[model samples]
Target: MELYAKVLNYTMPVFLLLILVEQLAARRMGKQVNRSLDSVSSISSGMTNVIKDVLGLTISLLTYDWLVGHVAIFKINATWLTYAVTILVIDFKGYWVHRWEHRVNILWNRHVIHHSSEEFNLSCALRQTVSTVFDYFAFLLLPAAVLGVPVEVMAVVAPIHLFLQFWYHTRLIGKMGVLEKIIVTPSHHRVHHAINPIYMDRNFGQLLILWDKWFGTFQEELEEEPCVYGITRPARTWNPLKINFQHFWLLLRDAYHARSWKDKLRIWFMPTGWRPEDVKQRYPVYTIADLQAYAKYDPPGSSGFSIWAWTQLLVCYGLLIYLFAHLVTIGFSHAAVYGGFLVLSIYAFTELMDRNPHAWAFELVKATVGLGIIYWLGDWFGASQQYPWLTPLVGAYQVLSFFVSAYFSAAIRAGQPLPEAESVHQHGA
Candidate 1:
């Protein structure tokens, strides 16, 4: 866990640098591919995902080591060739798992957070899932097992596989010539993220484009039919945790409302977006019918509010880095507590950004608990032991965060709109 955390901490700065570069690239092209609150939400979602992964929240029912040990018919020696085959096999597994998530009803909940963003930008690439607590897809690595790829080699290659997918998420890079046919590029991924009829559920490959083409799920970026990013039903909020489990909650509601047992039992496994006939007519969820008419979720925020959001993101990010760096110092239990505190910090600030009237209440709870932790530990997780004055500073920051939240709460209650946001062009749903 410590090593994994360290690796992620090292890579995060590179990802942030790329995001800034993408912002400049977008400006040069006269395109605005990112909105402030949405970008914060996206980055915050990444923090949650990182914390969850570092904390080891998920269970893989089958282990790759066990699979290779039991199933390998041929042994490949550890060399550059073995690592090359390892990455290819990993992406091959990714293609099937990603395709399943898009096609299966219950499984879509595991992936919705990544697609909840309405814009296509480098920041949105960080909006990964925090709620995929159980996965049984290790068996999908059968090809690698057959080739006798060592488990140690895969452990090093898995993260590289995921990180390589990040650079292609930006709109700043256009279609690459020959590379587009070989690997997953910006054009291919944009289509994968699109909700347009022609683009829906296409391009399931991650590192390679071969899987999509071979499986007939490939959709080229059309000149006339522009790619419209996001799902058919917009997530409409800036909270990643809520968005993560949205599909499951909808399925539960539909199951409860269904009049027949058959519909109730089948709703969970039905194709993605399928609803019972009776429940569909009676309790229709909001889905964007015309992509051209739909407005993206861009709540008007004053400059001060935008700055506050950035501050919140930075503080959480700093705390996360500290947690990663000092996991041994703080011990495992306190690390979990620290992780929970960061989650609360994100939830409170983001709810406030959504202009929730009760956002102050969440802030209050978060602050109170934060103070309680500092008081109970008497050092804010060993910080005062080093700085001799940092614990009090943290306590004050907690109080200040609450006041800021309450201030925005009152402003929202007064119905005072912030300055108007710039106009947004709608893409396909």
Candidate 2:
């Protein structure tokens, strides 16, 4: 089999597994796992935007390179130490960037989109700005690129970091107990995503918890006080364009309205939702006190089975992701990962558009697009070069994915209320 085909062999399994897991998580959380899936979709959109920006920047960088020969700051003599150092340094940079995004208004405007989620799950990690290449690329890649780090090495580093961080977005895993004392556990990150004032600005590390601990920003999850996920001000908007740019636009408006340059500077540099001269008043205060006011849900009488089924699905998805990793390391190029992501993006976007029964056609369109993406990635990754017979292997998976998505979409539309917080109570359903 070609490398793509080999990858597809594994990739298909991972996709199936993720879908299963998502279903399980949804059931466990007593909501449609769409929130989690939406997170993935949002992140995928941000990634796509980032890629487009990177391509443009690459062109500009190349143009500038003509004026000056390519130069690098680091040597290509990579060692274990180099890799370790690279990971640590990248992590630290991310920490600061993430922290700054929360602190500075302009940046926070972009970063807060992630925090706008009213629910916490694996997909929240995907909530980010695609145009943030300008803000993040240099800090992350420039140092390594200057040192002459191989692009291949750089590529692998990002995915590994992402893979490590991916599990942190979930509510499925509880605190790691002792490990939570040192590592960035899902429980720890939950605090970071909480709209609770005390939890805000805590636990910012992507892979390492040390940054938060070292910086005194670490806060343990409280057993008695449940974390209420999302920002004080929920976005409430569904327009992707608005969701992406709303904060930035708000910042610009505030900046323009300031009477003095100092006030304007403060507005831009200060934390998002901060208004000049307002000491105690903060915007979008989504405290536990606030959320408790909403009416509670009692899961449908059949939810025990739903939760169990969803759990099984999660296990399957996990297996699929693992298989994908193996396939990538074996013979597949980066395209396999990209292909898997394409399907993930499609799956996620489906959740986003699923709010309306009238959008059923959009669901079909997304599924078809996902199938096509799977086909392209399978062929592009070297399936045709190895075993042509294996081409149909991925093709089959794509077909299955499409049909499965359509089935789920129809099911969801047929009065199957998507998962919500109230749905997950132990006493319910």
Candidate 3:
């Protein structure tokens, strides 16, 4: 089997299990709990994105197509000693880069996108910078290629490193007694996600936690304190572009206000939202009293609509499975078909859930039925035999149905009413 097949094998079952667990967890939470089809779809999409990055790198490695500098920097001699050393060096480099992502403003601009979601689960791990691969290879792979690391060895090690980190992103695992001293554990990573002042800027390990312990950044997990995780400022929306660029935009604006070149550089490299001494920053720290006095944007709870939304999601997924199997049978490209189907399914399911919660379930079943009808038309009418072009048309129709379903889901999210704005009593006004 191809490497892609292996990755699929490793990833799909994890996602399916998480989906089931999340549904149960949501039910327990009640009050329109966070877990839904959108949640699972997000995780699946994230995995696909990660896989794309790996595929790109794998192709370059197999074809010996990386830059001369990259080849030299990431090169290894392909011996056991070299393999061991490569792992250590790459891990050490990852430690500092991971740490810098949390500390530096420009980097944090990219990193904050991952932390924007308040809900933490297996899917949250998949949320990442697509450009993360470029940045990672640029810095980390330089040494390996420079040293003449066999591309094959580096290739195997890199994905293994990544695959090892996958389960660490979940909420399921607790502490590992002695293992916690060596490699990163889920408990240690939860600390990294916490917004608590004490926990901030700690635990930057990817695979090995030893770097943190050696560098004095390690703090043992504290059950009593409990982790309250999320970014300091919430993203509050799901637009991927905005999630990626919001902090970047703010950084550029603040850099413009610097009194000197040094301050400007500092503004970009320092933690996000930093200012020079001459500049005064406005802080919005809502105290307990203040929160009680004015609490807009706070809804009581979700109406009883998630069940209907979920029904639609399940139906869409069922059709996706059938369509994928059919596409494979017809010799249509699995890479293109599966990739497109997954993206469309996620967007459509999200749209339906957000649009009309009451009709969401019915619409999902209806769409699935419509797909069956189309498949029957192609088969019974002998469209493939008569027109031949009708086959592609049916595929096109599937794509269109995906988009329409997505629109409905988005509409549902927007339909919920927001709190009223407060009146202003400015002296001038």
Candidate 4:
């Protein structure tokens, strides 16, 4: 875990830089692919995912080591060929797992966050999942296990493979000439992220496009059928926590009120977007039935609110970088506590950004928690020990955060219409 955190300390900045570059590049090309608030939400979602991963919040039902040991049919020598084969096996596993997540009901819960953003930009790619607490991706690694790939090799290669998928998530680049046929490019992934009928549930490749081509799920980007990003059932808020579990909550609601026992039992495993017939008719969720007239969720917000949201995003990111840098020195307990605080900090500011009427209350809770952490630890996990001013600065920020949140909360209370401000489609004023 420490190693992973350290690795991210290097890679994460690169990811940030690429996001900026993508923004600039798109603007240069006269395209508006990213909105400031949407980008903040996307990056905040990334931070949550990073914190969860660094804390090792997930557990596989079967360990890769155990799988390889029990199922190895032939022992392959540890050479370049071994690593090459490992990538292929892992990519194959990724293709099937991704396909299932888009096809099955329960599995989509872990993937919806990735597709929640209405805009298709590099930052939206960062909208990853923190909801996949007990994952079963290892079960899909049967071919790797059968090939007797070393566990160390898989560990080294898996993260690289995941990182490789990041660059292709941008919209700045169009179709790559020959490479389009061989690898997953921006065009292919745009299709994957699109909600248009032709683009829905296609292009499930990780590093290779061949899998999609072979599996008959490939769809080329057509100029006529322009891509409309986001899920059909829109994630209505700026809260990543809510978006992460919205589908699962829907499934839970449907299963409980489903009337028929068989319908309740099968709701979970049924095809993605399938709800009980009775439940669907009675409590219909708002889905965009017509792509022609659909609009992106964009609420009004003051310039002050946008700046504040960006500030919170930056501070939260800095806090995460600090936690990662000091993961070992701080120890697990401190890291966990700090991680929890970061989660609250994110939830507080983001809900406030959403312009929730009760968001100020969450902001108050977050401030109290921040102050409590400072008091309980006598420092911020050893930050005060190095930089004496950090503790007070962090404490001040918490207080300042609450006040800023209250100001916006007041605007929301005043029945302020958001038309004069920027967008995020919430109660934002």
**lDDT against the true structure, each candidate:** 0.88, 0.56, 0.56, 0.90
lDDT of 1: 0.88
Model 1 bad stretches (over 4 Å):
418-429
Assess every candidate by TM-score: 0.95, 0.59, 0.65, 0.95
For lDDT, the strongest prediction is 4
Each candidate's number of clashing pairs is: 0, 23, 26, 3
Could you tell me which 10 consecutive residues in candidate 1 have the lowest summed lDDT? Answer: 420-429
For residues 213-268, what per-residue lDDT tens digits would candidate 1 score against the true structure? 99999999988998788888788889888888888899999999999999999988
Selected candidate, larger TM-score, 1 vs 2: 1
Model 2 earns a TM-score of 0.59
RMSD after Cα superposition, model 4:
3.1
In model 3, where do residues sit more than 4 Å from their true spots?
Answer: 1-6, 18-34, 37-41, 44-48, 51-83, 131-147, 256-266, 273-429
* Model 2 worst lDDT window (10 residues): 59-68
Q: Write the per-residue lDDT of candidate 3 for residues 183-291, one digit (tens) a residue.
A: 9998888888876667878899988999999998998779877666566655544433345577776667666765678987788777654666654343232222321
| lDDT score at residue 127, model 4, on the 0-100 scale | 95
lDDT: which is higher, 1 or 2? Answer: 1
